[model samples]
Target: MARVDAAWYVTAGWALDLFQGRQTRDHDDIEIAVPAHGFPDVRRALSEFELYAIEDGLAHPLTPETLAISHQTWVREPATGLWRLDVLREPWDGNTWIFRRDSRIRLPRTRVIAYTEDGIPYAHPEIALLYKAKAVREKDEDDFAAVLPLLGPSRRNWLAKALTLVHPDHRWLEALRAGSTDTAAR
Candidate 1:
């Protein structure tokens, strides 16, 4: 059984380092986006460990307030050293900026795979990149930049499909494509 039953955007130290092709030395956290309905499962997954709350980024602002609910789950052993896992969940609505529950855009389970310590599933590369592209953070920019090249021709349809869902205005779309193109030319 999985922790959450909604679409999840999985990004963490491993994921970040993976996309960036670098080593992450710090005990960084993993971020996930989940629908409100999955809140109970998310709570159940992390109940055995410590919990912490963090504010959602302003660029990717949350509607209710500054602080977005999140929890940390971990177990440390003297010989095996400390094992830490952070899981953050917020509502996700594909049609707009914030999260709202809609069965229509709900992702299939197959699209998510085991990639992190918590056994939390992650959205496919295309879905992950779609969310990353909207982030516009420095690290996220780097991530988008890094992943786009590796995507090559395989991601053409994925890109088109995401555009239909997100429906970004022309200027932002051009900027994203231009950035991708400029990176490619280099």
Candidate 2:
């Protein structure tokens, strides 16, 4: 794989593991988020692999038009047909990380992301949880359960406010508001 110097952060289910400082479960594919504006750099870096824009349950070779419309892309090795990466193009305003659901809700990229001791960047657990909130699947639920207890007041408060804006009536709001650290009941 080729390496590129760009702002990329581990996201989704894998993000929870990064925040927890360990591997919590097996991951089928690694997920990374890049600013929509920097997608060209990513494409150049992964030029050896096949990149497909995933739209409405279909995979299409990425073209300028497809790149403009699709938010998610999957990278695979053509020979083996093995999916290697899941890339999420995220909205950004210079250095701010704009919430995909609500552009009005944004934070400085530095504040919304965390890095490991070795300098690997990952989305903050709260931000990852916010994305997971949209689809409360079994894995999402498990991820939420694992990360909730690790959140402190500031993180919890931030997530609560974000949820209020994006999903006012979300069930997780109550738990976050209550500052519940109980993961067992989840």
Q: Cα RMSD (Å) per model? A: 7.5, 1.8
- Per-candidate Cα lDDT values, in order, are 0.46, 0.87
lDDT of model 2 at position 3: 69
Worst 10 residues of 2 by lDDT: 177-186
For 63-83, candidate 2 gives per-residue lDDT tens digits of: 988887789999999899999
Candidate 1, after superposition: displacement of residue 11 in Å?
2.5
Tell me, by lDDT, which candidate is best.
2
* Ten-residue stretch with the least lDDT total in model 1: 95-104
Which whole-number lDDT from 0 to 100 does residue 163 have in model 2? 89
Regions more than 4 Å wrong, model 2: 181-186
Top candidate, metric TM-score = 2
